[model samples]
Target: MSSTCYLSLDWPTAPAWVNYNSLQQLSYFTTVFLAAPLALLTGLGMSPALSTRFRRISKLVSIQAARSLHFLVLVWFLVFLVVHVALVFTTDLQSNLNQMYAARGGDGWTGLWVFLASMAVVIGGWIAATPFTLRRLRALPHHEQITQHFCIQGWSGVTKWGGVSMRTILDLVKPRPEAKWVVFYSLGDGPDKWRYYDAHPIEQMSHRLTMLAYDMNGRPLSFGHGAPLRLRNEVQLGFKQVKWIEGIEFVADFSRIGGGHGGYNQDHEFFGYHQAL
Candidate 1:
């Protein structure tokens, strides 16, 4: 008599472990193990029973030192995040996502749903980071005055525009019924070079006009790089719109500032204000 048995086995090679540099591996391990455990220990250190032992440890690595180490690790994590993002863009993003999902042995329907969910998280996170969304959430509070320089304004060519939501900014200002004008004052480093456009009435202005917080390439605008806010007015030429705004005010006339020419536009400059398409 003879007996026959069949067996199936999966090996680690089936998953093909990706190689990581020492720093990369250490970063991943610390995030997964040491960091979490340290946090738990920090919390436990507050407990009365563990007070003696905790104090002993604390004396060895004093409280201030521990805090500094924790902060340093946090900064390290941020650096890791940058490297991770670079790798994601460098590699095939879809393939990586697919491989991760495939490891779960999910049915077709489940895999599809997971893919959709993952996409949603990425898109949702991007949207949440946008200036428009962030402003709505009060992440960038409307200040009475800010001295942002005009870093970049959209041009017909070779010009950059920060993605600023003009509609929301107008709403924040809430100009009076009698005040029909929107006056933008350039109060930054280049106040002398300030240009202004005879913008349309807030109500009449189309949504196309907005304060950009990001560039056309989807990159965030930094403070010095003309970020946090930008104005776009269809009624005025692109250059007339200011970037890195310092102050926004509602006034009856642009001439109130000086030289009855309304603004730099009224006084012919190199970039004359014209209605943009």
Candidate 2:
């Protein structure tokens, strides 16, 4: 995916200036050079109390600048990678890869690589614990004291809802003590049905009702697809479901909303949440 992403940027040639014409090169350099160095320096910077050298580097490079650069590079890389993957699916995908593994045809190296990459993705689930993930999840918290009205934007503004706290919602439908996983379902009327599931014991589940904090199927989920969070189920019909979610509850009856018709907004009515068939 990285190789394809770099290719999709269409960098026929490297430019002399920093802000080159190719966004691909910028992504590559930023990831390999700028962002990587900054990450290392950040860890060093954290030890300021112990190492003056670390303190000096952190002070000199301005935390904001380092952080901004890191995020920009990451976003660029992911965007390019997604495009590249789509193109691979479009082009001679098998031939393109077979060319590299021509010598080891049918060997286990390719399979091994796939397995390793999968492991890397699973291990990356740790990103949920980061401070950034927390902020996005906590964007909207459910408050019993306050009249909870969905304030998020959706189709025709009919679906009025915002994020609810993972803890708050989970508390409502307390899971079994042995419950191994929490599932979040987002069923849109369109082709946006999504499901986000997170295993327990790991802090991968964030407090955000919409923001999920985990990778999906050995790859990180991108934005619009509930990025920085793991999408469990298929996209469901409802804008309210688009937001972050941590857990899911299957209630046979939703009499308060509608008897035995407990689903999303679009499921019950022809709301703008779902597309016209």
Candidate 3:
């Protein structure tokens, strides 16, 4: 793919350049002298062993100028190659067509059409190459968000979070029609000997921003934040973001869960079970 990309950069060369006029003194000098030095410059420029010396050289010659010259050499080589290939094809169309088309004896137009079709496929592939390999922000069933968090404790702050969307989890679990809530359990226990836990409605769980976060501000969640994992339901208050989460239980209702409340705070402090904004 890299080779094809390098070659295709010079694909728009005019057909008329295939004639004897292109092999002038300048072209000959470039093919012999410039080609060898350009090759050496590219090698030394990329070499870790030579990097310090190369930097000193770069101060005098400028690495950008060397790179430009190397690229020009590549372009010249590609154009020269194309010209020779075109010359071969055009010099004896019938014979070359026979050789190219598996020695299948036929009219010259048949081989010409075949060549044109191959060129179309090559050009189309070149155009689509970048998009096929390009990736954005290293995401795979992941999202990054910067939002504010406010809790009943009167604490408020903003943070950037990175995690997998709850919607992705829903697609994997495929909850039954009766499962109305998702209960998240934490490894941390409260003073009352109950584990810190919370519940979210099935609809809220499917929200795009509702996620299981393992990253905070481009790094793994710190202990002060939630190490390992935490829940992030954007539409709700910060208390619902269960920290040090251990397990998840899908249920029809939260009545059977701890303290018959939807969350640890709701059970202990009489806070409302649902707080959405």
Candidate 4:
């Protein structure tokens, strides 16, 4: 199938069993050759090691772009599978089953049983998967309450956030003098999804309002609101305030990090690098 797509072979018109137009042939060719390779390349762009090692390519195909393209590829595959199966069943169910499972030209129950079992496994796995798990907060050296939540979409909320200041953690870590940026990584959509993260200039971390918040509204944060820890950067828009924070790193430059465009939203959504508004 892949070889035929790569060679750009002409669609077969003489076969009586195979009934497809030029449009269908073009769609199949595009899905196999173009979408499949693009999906693979975008998936590779999301890898932390690969993105760092191949900085230029990573920048060109930002992590968020890779995620979006990957989703589109999945949609295409699902559409193709549905159409292909419908066509086979409508045309000749017995012959199709025999060719696929029995590997012969005779009708038999062997193929039907095999298909049923494969579907059962897939459905069982889907049912077994669950949602996010709760994470607990650990002891911190200092905690303070601040009321400043700047939303980027023209609304703002003033909630008291309780947690340790970024400066205090920096003091403990003792980052190198040359470090000019701070990167915060957080949990996203699901366990299978890529980690959500953002980068801020080192100067922004010095602001008194910046901290790793663990409590909101005088209560421990719920899992939906980023339990354990979340970044609170008063100077930037709310999106830059990464939630469900897992780790923090001090780096001299962000060019080697994911997408190399200052932050995830900036790289993918074309948001301003310094969103003070």
Q: lDDT values of the candidates? A: 0.49, 0.40, 0.68, 0.72
**Distance from true position, residue 236, model 3, in Å?**
1.4
Clashes of 4: 0
Better of 1 and 3 by TM-score: 3
Report the number of the highest-lDDT candidate.
4
Model 4 lDDT per residue over 1-277, tens place: 3436424643222235456556578878988898899888987866554554475775577667887888998899888898678756765676677677667655676776777788999899886763222232245555676575656577877788888888877776788999998988765522323345788888888888888888888898888788877888888877788887756778898886666787767667765577554
Order of the predicted models by TM-score, top scorer first: 4, 3, 1, 2
Residue 11 displacement (Å), model 2: 14
Q: Write the per-residue lDDT of candidate 1 for residues 1-277, one digit (tens) a residue.
A: 0111101222123234366546557768977787767756654433322322243554465434555666766676687688665554345444454556655432234444666798899999997765434455235432221222333353244344444456656665567777666655442323332233233345433354445344534455666654655555544544556655544556555444433444545555434333334
**Which candidate tops TM-score?**
4
- Model 3: residues with Cα > 4 Å off, grouped in runs: 1-140, 152-155
Task: For candidate 3, write residues 14-72 as lDDT tens digits.
Answer: 33333434334566677678876777777555332232223355345543455576777
Error of 3 at 112 (Å): 65
What tens digits encode model 2's per-residue C-alpha lDDT throughout 35-98? 6676666544333121222334544664345556666656766876787565444444444334
Each candidate structure's TM-score, on Cα atoms with residue i matched to residue i, is 0.36, 0.29, 0.48, 0.50
Tell me the TM-score of model 2.
0.29
Ranking of models by lDDT: 4, 3, 1, 2
Look at candidate 2 and tell me the lDDT of residue 191: 28
